[model samples]
Target: MRADARKNYEHLLTVARKVFTEQGNDASLRDIARRAEVGLGTLYRHFPTREALLEALLRTSFGALAKRADELQASSDSADALITWLQEIIAFTHEHRGVIAPMVSAIEDHESALHASCVTLRSAGAALLARAQADGKARADLDGSELFDLIAALAWLREQPSHASRADRIFGVISGAILARRP
Candidate 1:
């Protein structure tokens, strides 16, 4: 790309991320173009659709999350790795409010551009979950998909950071139910 075009592309992406985070998926494309000081055509030239923009904005974070899960799984205990990964997912969602709903839907829609990223995010902690279950540390019945929804639930409650205590209590209950009971 040419220098000016590259500059415009980068600026639009930065502005779009801010606008989308502040106003959500329904954030106006024209508003994004105005904020980026670019034409709507330019924005469209770079991102053909709103979902495309959303996918672009989320890709790096999801990639980082997958990498983090790998690193944690390699270095941490089975159950500990899964817990740490879940917390990181909650943190990621907090950074990008209103994104979870789209992600949840896209993950189930194989045709969505964001679907693969969601799958990567889901699979990240899944290995740890499997490892824990196999090691007799976690419940065999629950899988990573359940943990995925649980993390999303925690992210949805992020407005009340003070709810950490309540979250911890709930998580404790879940852990007790999911952890293997020794004789």
Candidate 2:
């Protein structure tokens, strides 16, 4: 990319992050272009779709979450690692707002722009869950897909204003159900 084009791309990403943080992932692309002082056509040239823009914005976050999972998996107790990663991922999705839906949708849609990142995030959490289950700290009946679904469900709950206050308590209940009792 040319220097000016790269600058515009980075500036758009920065402005988009602020807009998304304030208005959520569903914030208007036109508004982002306006905020970034770029033409709508320029924005489209850089990110052809809303999901493409989101994919660019969240790529680093997705990788960080995956890396955090690896760090937690190696450094923490099995059950603790799974729960911690769950809490972190829920926080991540909640922080972005409105992203959970697309993420959930992307998990099953191979053609989605967000599919690869969502899959990587899910696989990271799944690995932690697997470690917990292998250590006999988690329920044997659960699988990676179910765990991913649970994360999506929990993250979605956090998005609801009515349920936001109860999210932590609800998370505790769900996590408790996923774990085995100590002897």
Give the Cα lDDT of each candidate: 0.82, 0.93
lDDT for model 2 comes to 0.93
lDDT string for model 2 (19-133, tens) is 9999998899999999999999999999998989999999999999999999998965999999998999999998998999889888999988999999999899888888999
Off by over 4 Å in 2: none
Task: Report the C-alpha lDDT of model 1 over 114-136, residue by residue, as the tens digit.
Answer: 99999998888778788889888
- In lDDT terms, which candidate is top? 2
Tally clashing residue pairs in candidate 1.
0
TM-score of predicted structure 2 = 0.97
- Worst-scoring 10-residue span by lDDT in model 2: 69-78
